[model samples]
Target: MTSPLSGIRVLEIGDRIATAYCGKLLRDAGADVVMVEPPAGHRLRRYRPAGVPPSAGDSPFFSFLSGGKRSISSPTVPPELVDSADIVILGSTPAEAADLGLDVDEIACRTSVITVSNFGWSGPWIDVPATEFTLQAWCGSTGSRGEPERPPIAVGGDLGEFIAGSYAAFFALAAHRGGGPFDMSVLEAMTTSMQVFSWLRKELMLLEVLGRSTEVPSVERAKDGYVGISMATGQQWQDFCAMVECPDLADVPELRFQVGRWEQRDLIRARTADFFATHTVAEIVELAALFRIPMTAIGNGETLSSMDHFIERESFLSHPSGFRAPRAPWRMSATPPLPPALPPALGDTDSPWTPRESRAERTGLPLDGVRIVDLTAFWAGPTATHLLGMLGADVVKIESVQRPDGMRFAGGFREDVERWWEYSWVFHGVNSGKRSITLDLGSEEGRALFGRMVAEADVVVENFTPRVMENFGLSYDELRGFNEQIIEVRMPGFGLDGPWRDRVGFAMTMEQLAGLAWLTGYPDGLPTAPRGACDPLAGVHAAFLTLAALEHRRRTGQGQLVELPMIDVVLNASALQVIERDVAGVLLTRRGNRGHEFAVQNVYACAGDDQWIAVSVRDNDDWHALKAVLRQPVWAHDLIYAEDTADLIDGHLADWCKDQPRDETVSAFLAAGIPAAPVVQPPDVIDNAALQARGFFQTLDHPLCGPLPYPRPPVTGHFVNSAAPLLGQDNAQILGSSLGLTAQDLARLEDDKVIGSWPLGL
Candidate 1:
């Protein structure tokens, strides 16, 4: 079957995960992607897995990201080929691109160009070196992870780079139908991907103002292992207590509401902790599912690999290292992805496509003329609709006046403001570019109005539990009856048919359940929540699948239901651990901030309070370069140190770095061609020069917030209406324009409480 991107040509420059994975996505969609590496080949190719034959030339990390793409060693490719390409993905800094003689403007004029970087081309820290750890730190994710007493720990693997790559692929595909010179900052991508924390932080500020406590237990240990539990609603809390056979606690008035539970969290935690200690993870999971409680085992690599669902779904591809690699996060009936293939050898000139006639001129954004009815709240589902909105879809977000999106009230900023909803940067950030209309789906009139809107919408999206749509009479079958061509995308924590389908889950709990928490943190320490990365990961998958469904409908003239189980998407993101467990029959364990693949990798203290730098030495050349940068100290030249004795080398490296400024240490190591970066915090990320130069942050003058810096979506060359609609801001416009409802009708609906511009109590 011909893939969606069959005729497209993608040129990937740089060996970084972001660019490589972006190319992989394009390749999966049947694009002819050619990766260009330096003369020595890409640095990632040298990342050899233990016991792998050298002739294989396959590094699990590199192969997983760069698979199904051709390669060329030369820095400079022919300009004719560049001109003929449909997209160019550059993973280098602005300086590196200029040095390579790759004119960004000239290339963008001919085809789309997406430049991915650490901070961005024009940010103040654009020249400052960075790594996954530092990016997470600067983005606020690391700071929120683990126990507050312990120093922040980075999440396992290059999740920041992985997320940036997903954004790059989405933007590239969007630009292909339009045109571009887009720029993406890994830091910004990571920040936005996990923006749910921003909301939580804001909630804390409001709680403080209201004299309320803000404390909750994210992870707790069971008899054999750990499990994550979330009781967002009072009913879930009651169910959890009942499942544990704690009828007395379930009846306690303080444990009835989420706020009351927070106020008396210490007492509640002590009781639950003891109860959890008496049960095993499997037993807890079973009871939670049976009782419709929001609790799940903190699975490890072994548990994930042994799962029947993933194995049956064929979520992984075989790896040469006896492990496995993740397949694309989506599948389709028609226009399915191309089969996976190993990354091509450097300088291999194999081309998958022959010259074709120039395509006809493309006009508006890729999703132009499409309309979506968005019934999602928080990050994941909203993020999907936001991306679609940026791609020129007319998205109408429906919220009830009685139950507004929590983000509207959870502004992370402390402002002397009157109307709180208008000042919510968290809500505005993700909801921008979409219209808003209030509809109480519980009401008969509201349901009738929603059906009318769905009839005109091409897509309907919701992230509620399995029973929500059915309860509201807005399920896929009902929507299909209203409009046969309407595509319905449902994002539930578990799938619709599973025993756990009714269980409640947030991003934090889902991460633990999917084994991400167990894979992070110190070796002997407890599991840590990796913030909200799972939400954006799921969001990206939902958006990609939605587009695929749209394409299928375009060809077949039929629409279908798209189910995106949040747990499945999160597990797929951590495919490495599953693969390792599958191959080695052992669960992967956390190693703190240490690198598993590199010989010498650790975070070391540097000059200044709380300042640090991360360094990774992969081989002899890297060791030599690092030693030279450190002034060739006697200890650095030791054979034991050179032989990958990471624990022993870490102490010596820490001593060496203690007196050196973080920037200096990072610069020296980078200049010497060693992988090193400073641990930048959130304050350092703001007011960054590169981000400023690239206009990564835009100032939107909100009515209540005045003006605030909003991070632009990591894509360019498309219509981005930056204004986020106020509550029911588009009620009149939408009612009159689409549904032909008169102002009197809207007033009547408002009087009947079927529509409103603000929350009922507020």
Candidate 2:
């Protein structure tokens, strides 16, 4: 079968999760992505899981991100090849770019480039060095993420940066259509994730106003195993009470639930804990399901593989190197990216093609002919389209002086700065092969131009609050009036028509309101949000909805609206929580890092502090492996043979894990045919040996970010190169040639500031 992104060629420069992930999406969709590796190779290549070998090919980071793309090694990139390539992605600091003699202006004038850097190329701290932890701390996510009073915790993985890259990919596609070498900020992309938190702060203001100050209980563990529960809606509360068999909760006057419940939640929680102890997990889950209360067992990425729903739905695939990942989140009827290749070795393929003339032709991107007009600024909306761009859509991003997405300044940078787009490590990941066009949508002229673009577009996506569209006179009805085939997707903090519809929110706020915050972190502690938790998951939902909308449009020839309230999406993810509350009257509290049931669950630290292991026991089949490594007969002899071993499992497992090296144990178990793997650290993920054998990470040389590692494309199939773009780099050629704009018109647009070559003062 023919691939979607056939005949598309992409050049990825700055090798980070964001750019790499974007390139991966494009490659999955069938684009030919050529990753340029710096002299030292991609940084992620050095990252290793505990006890795992540290080899370039073993980098899971590289394996997962670059599975489909080819790698090229070069420290200092020449301009000729970049100009000829369809996309160029670079991640760097201003100092780094300048030191490397990478002139953004020169590149923009020459070709389309997507520059990914620390604080954008023009910001006050544009040259500042940063890491995932620092960004998380700077953004207040680290401070706000875990228990309220404990030392702030960074979210697992370089999530903020990764989501930002996803957003960048969407913008790149948009620019690809509008034609540009455009600049985007990882910071702006990350800001989208903060919406919930921002809104929560506003809600806190109202609490102070109402003089409803009250002492709340910190989250506490119940007698049962650790479980994640939520109470987002009034219905959820009602369901929760019912699941725990507490019909009397309907009469509890002090609880004052809903959003207001947050301040007084501790008291209500203490009172509610007594009720949860009465039931088992089975009862809680069965009951929650009957009532539609949102809940779930808190789990890591690896644990998701064993879920019956996931297995039945076929959420994982085994690569050649023996690593399995969740299936690319979306299922498409046509041109799906599949059959991921293993991570490559440095200079793995020998081709004597000169950089300038040997552009890899990409005609096989999964969603090649699809068109998307992306209006998303931050994490969720941008992430959705980023995935779409990977699937081969022609995505054009709308930007303007009046309104720039917050990520432009929020990922991890000072407020007052120009060229803030470059410092965004996050932006580099989500966007790769899109196009860019600046328009003042709030102005009549801009709106008119947008309407014209919509008339020629297939999809319109935005993650702004619901009313923003109506205020701009750009609602679904308005857009459909212009183009009946358009699909409009709106992702608000909450649903468009609810009591809390106007309430502002970010990722934190959503977690709070969704009841997820109330259930995370250590017991008897302050509420906490997931680490960059909502963005990627929400992105998955958005991408799934877009594909569904596209399929619907295909059949009906009618435009449709796709709405994803961030809170609702969270509830969907936490469906298990809802089930327990509604049917079983179970009110779940928090449990820090502990797995539910504690039956064959753990991510233990190894002797080498940097290494770790993720283990699970579905049944009793893997007992021997655990027994062999732990040197305890209880696991195999006692637990397996005993009629009732449940009571002793947790204590025995804890004792066995205390002194063992997580990675070595995992390796021993895996060698013994057990289900085990070391917990992969963000930096170490790029060097996982199994991932290397599977051909995961692809290398790309960039002018700025040096030789970098990009995660391979998620889908496995007959796709090729997965490169990112240079900002507005394609502007002159596309406007002058494809858009039929005369040189005078291009000059006029530039003069009018309707569009500029780069947002940064290149």
lDDT of each: 0.72, 0.54
* Highest TM-score against the true fold, candidate: 1
Model 2 residue runs over 4 Å out of place are: 49-57, 99-101, 195-224, 248-259, 349-457, 460-537, 540-762
Per-residue lDDT of candidate 2, residues 1-762 (tens digit): 434455556777775677787777666656677777777787666543222333434455466667877777876665655666666676766556666557877776555566776445543444444444334433434334333333233343345665566555654553344333445555434433532333222221222111111122222243453344544334456666666666676566434243345555665676668755665544554465567554443433323345454455444566555455534443333344556787667766445234454323333454678889888876667777776776678888776644555454343332354454533444545554567666667667568767877888888889887778899998877887999777787887656664445544555445543455555555555455563468665775677557545545554565667666675555433433332343233445554433332234444445653344445553465565567666766444645522246336645765666578765675576566555544332333334342343333455543334344443333222122433334455556555565567888767766766666456332
TM-score of decoy 1: 0.86
**How well is each residue in 464-572 modelled by candidate 1, as lDDT tens digits?**
9899889998777799889988888889877675455677787777788777788677788777667668888788767876776676677678787777778766765
